[model samples]
Target: MKILLLSFILLGLYGFCLGAGGGGVSSSTSSGGGSMKETEDTKRLREGRPLILTCEQNATNLETKWTKDGNELVAGDHIQLFPNTTLYISTAQKEDKGEYSCKTGSMTEPKIFHVVELTLQKHLPKSTTVLENDKLSLSCQVQGDPELTVQWLKDGEPVEDTDNSTRLEMSDNEYDVPNAVLSIKPIQKSDSGNYVCLISLYSINVNTTTVVRVKDIYAALWPFLGIVAEVVILCLIIFIYEKRRIKANFDDSDSDPAQDVKNNVDGKKENDIRQRKH
Candidate 1:
């Protein structure tokens, strides 16, 4: 009876220990699963470049599985989990832009994530307009994380002149300062044409054209001279009218004196004749 009681006690103790161990393992798995679900996802990519995807986890030993648009990625696409947990595509095309997800074996569901969309865009400079004979300065602007290089072109030909007359200046900004200043001293009429500025970066080129019209200085001067001539003619007309009026007044005064003298003589003769008749 004593031996049987000892055996029963040992069996009961073993059962309790096994149950406690299983419960501890279940709790640990549940906590690990919760942590995987709460993992944060971040994605970023440059415009017109390849896309990069990343996965992260709070736990150190967690395994990560990557999928794209509900399809399982092959061994080539599987990215190992790290602190940063990033994957790179050599050249991200438009077709590769989509949603992605990551999951661990300890998690119940996959964590929804996204891949940065790589879009190729062409950026040109602002269109500038200036009066003829004045300095023409223009700059091309492009916004991106990485700075861009700028180039200048005139009428489909690259401007080879770098002697401050037609040169491109570089800067570390997306929009470069007036890198190119076209100085045309005493602009001639022949300078009027399509002035084009071409900006190139990473095999992508953008062009902007401005129609420059070298206004004929004579075109503006002729009208001004015409206005001045009209004013001078008007002043002469006013002076001539005043002079003619003054001359007419003087002539009328002289004629009045002669008429008065003749009238007096006639009256005296009439009186003498009347007296003789009487």
Candidate 2:
């Protein structure tokens, strides 16, 4: 009778332990959320990265459930729930930014997962019309990680910015977002193409394109017109010099004709007198 009572007591204790929630929290393991280089109780991931969260419990008949921000996690294209109590996130997004918890018949500490949001926000013009030699300004509004870099491209190729000209500027706005500007003092016809603002961070790149339509009036004929004006000025100077030289020669010739005739008559008279004397 004592043995039977002891068996009942032990069975009751086992049932009581099962009714209460204690074994699952202690036996469950939180692992597999980062890369091989990093492992921690919680994970900090950037957007588009992949991660896995595994759970292990001591209960045999228990089923594991995953929750995000106190809401039940659903299996979707980007999220997969495995039978081995694993939750996989294929491509992390900003929406996935919250605390993640594994529920195995008990509520436990949630692992905070930080997802770094990446974005390229810009106000781009489809087509801009400006007169030739006018100032051109192309701006892009960008909001993302500060580590993100900005690049300028023209006509599907990279722009050469080796000079680091003052035409390009990067400033922070009120919210500390990057505001990039590419300004040209005298907009040329060559600058009238598709200008691209490329923003990149990690392996993701986003760009916006704009076209500049420059109205150049007689642009090709300008050099020829300048050459014609120079030639015309040179010819005018030469013509004036030639006319002054001809006038001077004509004035010198007019004073000589009458004097030469008188001198010739006097010389002949003098010659006849000398001949008579001889």
For candidate 2, the lDDT comes to 0.60
TM-score of each: 0.44, 0.37
Predicted candidate 2 versus true structure: per-residue lDDT over 69-185, tens digit per residue? 678888898899876667788887767755577766554754344333444443466666555666666666656542556677777666665332444444554346454566675
The candidate that wins on lDDT is 2
Mind giving the per-residue lDDT tens digits that candidate 1 earns over 1-278? 34654555565555545433321111111110001011234244434565555555335555567778898764454233343445566655555545678776666877766543212233222223333454444333333222334455555554555223332333333333233334444444455455565543333344555554544333434444544555566667668888999999988777677889999999999999999999
Off by over 4 Å in 2: 1-114, 161-179, 217-278
lDDT of each: 0.48, 0.60
Best by TM-score: 1
